[model samples]
Target: MISPEDYNRVKDKVITIDVRTKNEFEMLPHFDWAINIEFSEFISNYEHYLRLYNPDNKLIVTVCNAGNRSGQTSQFLKEKGIDALTLQGGIYNYKRKFK
Candidate 1:
């Protein structure tokens, strides 16, 4: 998992995928640049994700309201040979630390 400080240091060099549901995402404060991909959609369309994000090309960071979902998603991506990391403590920690 990546700490908010570490993420902030490399924010410009990484792609952040927020896996929160649409309703949750719309109602919460999130990074303006994060890509909103609902967790279910990401799981269902993993091939599409693989096509878009290449481990060798860019770092992938998964996020959610808390770390749980993102952690699971990161594991799934890694099992599929994609290098992915979760935001430690997710957006809540990020907001607590940086916002």
Candidate 2:
């Protein structure tokens, strides 16, 4: 998992994927630059995401309201040879620290 501070330090060099549902993602406050890929869809169509956000040249950071789902997503990506990390404590921790 990546801490909020660490993520902020490399925010420009990474791709952040917000794995929340559409409703939650749209209604909640998330990093403006993050790409939303509802967890279920992301898991089902990971190949699409892998092609769009190839981790070969860029780091991928997964985030959810809390850390659970994002952590799972990160693990799944890693199993598929993608370098991915979960936002420590997810967006909640990020907001507590930086928002």
Candidate 3:
């Protein structure tokens, strides 16, 4: 997992995937460039989402409220050879550090 500081370093060079539900996403603070794919549909529609935003297969940064879901997503993506990484403390810690 990468720290929020590390995330900031590559934010512009990578694709940020928010694995939160649509409603949660709407209610929470988030990055403007992040794509909301939610965890449930991430695996099934990953390619489509990637095609819609980042077809170049850039490094992917997965994030959630507390890192759990994002961690799982990162593992799955890594297994599929997607070169994905999870945000070390997720958005909660990220906010604490950056807010």
Candidate 4:
């Protein structure tokens, strides 16, 4: 899990994928560069995004409203051979750290 502080330091060095629902995504403050793909959709559509990202070349950072969903998604990505990471505490932690 990557801490918010560490993420900030490497923010430009990683690709952030937000696995929050559309509703939650709309209501929350997140990174402008984050790609919003709901967790449910991620299971089926992730490969497409993976192709677009070429995960092997970039560090993928998964995040959610909290950490649980992103943690699961990160595990799945890892199993698929992508070098991925889950943000510790997710958006909640980011907010706490920044605001």
Candidate 5:
């Protein structure tokens, strides 16, 4: 399992995938470097976004508002043979524990 501490340790080298709504991301405090894929957009325009991401540059970490969606996304990527992990408790926990 991916731990927040470890995530913090390697955050700079990791690619954080924010799976929250665009409005939610805009309203919240989060890592500045995180990439937003907004869940709805991800569902409707997945291929387009995937093509835009350079997954080779960093280790992938999928995160949702709460860990649910990220976990599901991570599982999908893993099954497709992509290297990815989820932020264990999502941004809510990040706000509580790290922010």
Candidate 6:
């Protein structure tokens, strides 16, 4: 798992997965760097992310509103044999600290 500060240092090299509902993401302010994969469809489409973005050992940073969903997503990815981890606090924290 990467700290928000550490992640920010290499933000360009990381892929941020926002595992929040599409509506939730839209309702709040937007984050250009994040890709939304709603919690409901996360498990089914996770493989696609594993295949497309960072297929061959690329780093992934999973994020959620406050970290719960992203934390779960990290576990799911780890179970699937991917080296994925969660963002410490998620977008709520990101916006507060960075934006």
lDDT of each: 0.87, 0.91, 0.90, 0.88, 0.78, 0.80
* TM-score of each candidate structure, all chains considered together: 0.91, 0.93, 0.94, 0.91, 0.84, 0.87
lDDT (Cα) of model 3 = 0.90
lDDT of 2 by residue, 1-99 (tens): 999999999988998999999898889879888999999899999988778776465889999998999999999999988889999998988999986
Q: lDDT of candidate 2?
A: 0.91
Off by over 4 Å in 4: none
Better of 4 and 5 by TM-score: 4
lDDT score at residue 48, model 2, on the 0-100 scale: 81
**Could you tell me which residue pairs clash in candidate 1?**
none
Pairs with backbone N, CA or C atoms under 3 Å apart (clashes), candidate 6: none
- Lowest lDDT sum, 10 consecutive residues, model 6, at 49-58
lDDT of 5 by residue, 18-68 (tens): 888888789876667888887666656755666678536456898877799
- Per-residue lDDT for 15 in model 3? 91
lDDT per residue as tens, model 6, 8-85: 898788777788889988898656788888876878887776677676677778888788988988898898888788
lDDT of 6: 0.80
Candidate 3 C-alpha lDDT tens digits along 1-99: 999999988899999999999998999988778889889898788878878877888999999999999999999999988899999989989989988
Model 4, position 16, has a per-residue lDDT of: 90
Task: Pick the winner on lDDT between candidates 5 and 6.
Answer: 6
